[model samples]
Target: MAPSRILMAAIVLVGLSGFADAPQRYVVSYSVSDHGVAQMRGQALISEEGDVSVQGSDQDGGHAFNATLNPTDDGLVLVTSLWRGATKLGEPTLAMERGGQAKAEFGSDQQRVVIEIAPAD
Candidate 1:
């Protein structure tokens, strides 16, 4: 093979390898419904390891929570105590991947949050 051709092939292989090594990214979003009333909506970026960095806002403009949802053996786990600027909420909520529903109780009200995490198209 020609030396120039071999070098060009090597460069192409290295560039492709860089793309292969890039981490997988997922765009996840969620909707919070309080007894069927929409309360908050947010989206997040999920890495290959299922580490979530979320940004959310209450639709009513009174409260907000920025929390991390870590993937677990069963599903995604959320600790309500880690919720910023909120109280009277449930703890240790699990968003099952197969079930597709994440719910928590705030006092007498129940908040059911739907989480969707699909591969980027």
Candidate 2:
């Protein structure tokens, strides 16, 4: 599939809206894909408090990544720690916003897309 087509396919699946008073839960999922082959896949549930817990894996095996999304002066700050077993890989921080949809690409030509899907109330 073409890059655009693949991107469109990976668009976030949003659910129905809920009551205004309740805190919303968002299901965020993404895959690092090259030519339709998923090199790594991850999914996370982001609470209203901005806590993010993600589990993902590649061909070698699985790993866990944890990050805290806190409100910042710009938008939001995501501090990520990647782990394989007990070994800590690296920490990459990104400042971004939570909105409708967004897309990003890695250095290896792998496409990463983020979709925020809220649960029905």
Candidate 3:
């Protein structure tokens, strides 16, 4: 192959490797329900290894969630903590692959939180 062509191919491969390591962005959506009634719903944008926290209050109580989007060899994992009022809801995690979606539900009938994560558009 021509020397120029070899150099161009190397440049292209390096550029593609840079893209592979580029940070990924995702949309995180959640819903907090009290006794099966929607108490709060919110959305946030996050990047790989970024943290997001959201909280809201209503007449009944307050709802809050903290989560981090982390990358893994197999897929992505959302490490999260959920809370309703002063009580801490169960810690839930959503695991998904690239270009996929995942959800984690915590709590029971009294207070519940559902978190969904997806690759951002």
Candidate 4:
């Protein structure tokens, strides 16, 4: 099968397995070295099949964002954006860590941001 088809299959399998119930909303604090400190409140949905969806926003500007993390045989894949609607503003495939904590890195027109997510409570 093609790679895209396989990915689609995995997504479907993960969705059907009910992994989406494992995560919940939480507050995450992140640091951007030269920029400053930023905090966001978002939801993390962990599926039974190893898929994760995390979303959050900056309270000051209401700039919301979300990310979907999918675990594969190799590692994890991450997709993020800065919009609330169905349309994704920015989608970048960033590196991720397995098991305990995961991290994502992406660049925008202005700056580069790295996000780290710990296990949801």
Candidate 5:
């Protein structure tokens, strides 16, 4: 092989590797409904490690939660907690679909939440 051709190939490989190492970022927005009222509006960050950070506002001040996601046979299972100051308020079971939607239920299914994501504007 010619020396110039070999150098060009090496440059292409380096550029390709850089592209492969880039991280993916997604912004998810969702709402929760309770009784006949839409109670909350929130957003979450889904990272490469399947870790999530979510925050929203409702009638009860502002709320934030964090959890790690693990893939299951049925779907993605999430364990989340509510926080106020340094106190741990509640932990709940949540479910997520890869590249789809997610929901978290609270208080005996009295509350149902839905999350959806799309390309950022």
Candidate 6:
């Protein structure tokens, strides 16, 4: 059997429309891939906060995904909890800054899931 891949992307636009040159729009792109193959992808425009999820079936088996995002005290950064089949993955944090990024990989010998968040250009 082959491994499955899931990619999620999130983009946020804040502040007034007049400020077009301003960096008010934050882009968050999530990518979950294995062996350069992608089975799922996601993108979102968040005002204050946002939630993105993807569910589908591939050659391996069925897949289910769920997640919610919330603002942090420092601003421009978000945090969300991860779960894999009732197992608490972790409280991963999301950052809009290019220097600040988060990533985590989990799975067994049969399968591997790599979750990554970037500045989304």
lDDT of 5 by residue, 6-91 (tens): 99999999999998776444565555567647676566766434677666655566766666555677656556565534555456
Best by lDDT, which number? 3
| TM-score, candidate number 6 | 0.45
Q: Model 1: per-residue lDDT, tens digit, 1-121?
A: 9999999999999999999887555556555677788776666665444555444454433444334456677755543332424552333444545324445433334766554554443
Better of 3 and 6 by lDDT: 3
lDDT of 2: 0.53
lDDT of 6 by residue, 64-113 (tens): 45445455666545555444445554555655442344565655534445
Minimal lDDT window, size 10, model 4: 25-34
On the 0 to 100 scale, the lDDT of residue 58 in model 6 is 59
Clashing pairs in 5: none
Question: Of models 2 and 6, which has the larger TM-score?
Answer: 2
Across 1-121, the per-residue lDDT of candidate 4 in tens digits comes to: 9999999999999997776555443222222222333333344545323444444444434445556666667755555555434444455555444545555556553444555655555
Instruction: Give the runs in model 2 whose Cα sits over 4 Å from its true position.
Output: 1-24, 34-36, 56-59, 83-92, 98-102, 110-121
TM-score of each: 0.53, 0.48, 0.71, 0.41, 0.49, 0.45
Stretches of candidate 5 exceeding 4 Å from the true structure? 1-5, 17-30, 57-59, 70-77, 82-110, 113-121
Off by over 4 Å in 4: 1-34, 37-61, 83-90, 105-112
What is the per-residue lDDT of model 2 for residues 3-119, given as tens digits with 9 covering 90 to 100?
A: 988776665322223244445455544444556576556767664457776776656777676756565566555555656566664455655554422333343444432322333
Q: What's the best-to-worst order under TM-score?
A: 3, 1, 5, 2, 6, 4
